[model samples]
Target: MKKYLVVLVSMLGSLSMMGQTNTWVNDPAHSRLGFVVKHLTISEISGRFADFSVKVTTSKPDYLDAQIEVTAKIASMDTGVEMRDNHLRSADFFDAEKYPTLTFKSTSVEKTGKDKGKLHGNLTFHGITKPVVVDVVYFGTVTNPMNNATTAGFQIKGVVKRSDFDLGPKFPEAVISNDVQIIADVEFSPNK
Candidate 1:
């Protein structure tokens, strides 16, 4: 009876270990969410969303089993020009009042190298949900010299069609390009 109890306890402990997950929260001060879009076929205009949050969760050390979620406030968009920023929040563009947030939830993560991978997810913007695959670079983790807290860094690049997300003006690829390039530099720390 003692032996059976020991085996049962060990099995339960193993099961609990297998189910454990680690969570990391974004450090906004060290992260950025930015995008580039063409302007009048002249040059590219770049901007960033100043308010956003990201969370990563995984049970695996390699992060191959990671799940990521991000939420960004639409009103936080900044393009340097106040007029352009206001236009982006208007009805012809992001319609920020109706859809105040853009979000992404990872559906899968595919490892390609020791520090590279592809993150597949659904991005919801302007009331539309579209699948997107982002090229990822994991910069690994480090202990901050100032605070001694462990932090991880990552960079992601992706593109999404503005039309697909029902954002911005229509039929003007020559003007504002349909394709928007998204680039993010993210830093994460263990959730407290």
Candidate 2:
């Protein structure tokens, strides 16, 4: 009976230490929200937003039951050249002044393969909210040496029609494709 009691106590102690599913904060230094798009139908141009935030709450190491919210500042666009970045922020494209932020909210997390799944979320861009399914591939986790925080994130891929959200009307006359690819990588550390 004593041995059984010790086993039960140990089990409860283990569970008690696990306050909740891996609650992580966004580690901006090691995380980024990047995007790709066809530039003039000649090549793919990649850009990243320097300002963003994310909060993740799911950690089976291979799965997530997370509610993620990302807010990207329009002025943080970087596309290798200052002129192009300014244009992208203008009314011809993102219209950074009027719509200063883009957002995403996860609705459900579905498990799929050995270490991948689909995160269905409502993505709001240019004031149009649409249900977007992002192919989420988990990249595992590690302890940050600098902060001593456990960190993890996933690569999310999705496509959105630029016209659907009234993003860029001028692009229709040029080689700018209607479909734009959005890729996001989120790295979160513990809220503590």
Instruction: List the lowest-lDDT window of 10 residues for candidate 2.
Output: 56-65
Superposed Cα deviation of residue 142, candidate 1 (Å) = 0.6
Choose the strongest candidate by lDDT: 1
lDDT string, candidate 1, 1-192, tens digits: 999999999999988877789899999999999999998888999999999999999887678899999999999999999999999999989999999999999999999998999999999989999999999999999998887888999999999999898776654899899999999999998897
Candidate 2 residue spans exceeding 4 A from truth: 1-7, 16-22, 59-63
TM-score to native of every candidate shown? 0.89, 0.87
Please give the RMSD of candidate 1 to the true structure.
4.5
Candidate closest to the true structure, highest TM-score = 1
Which pairs in model 1 have colliding backbones?
none
Each model's backbone clash number: 0, 2
lDDT of 2 by residue, 1-192 (tens): 999999999999888765557666687887788888786778888899999888766645455667777788989989889999999999888889988988888898898887688889888867789888878888887887887877776788888777888877866625777777888877877787
Cand. 1 TM to true fold = 0.89
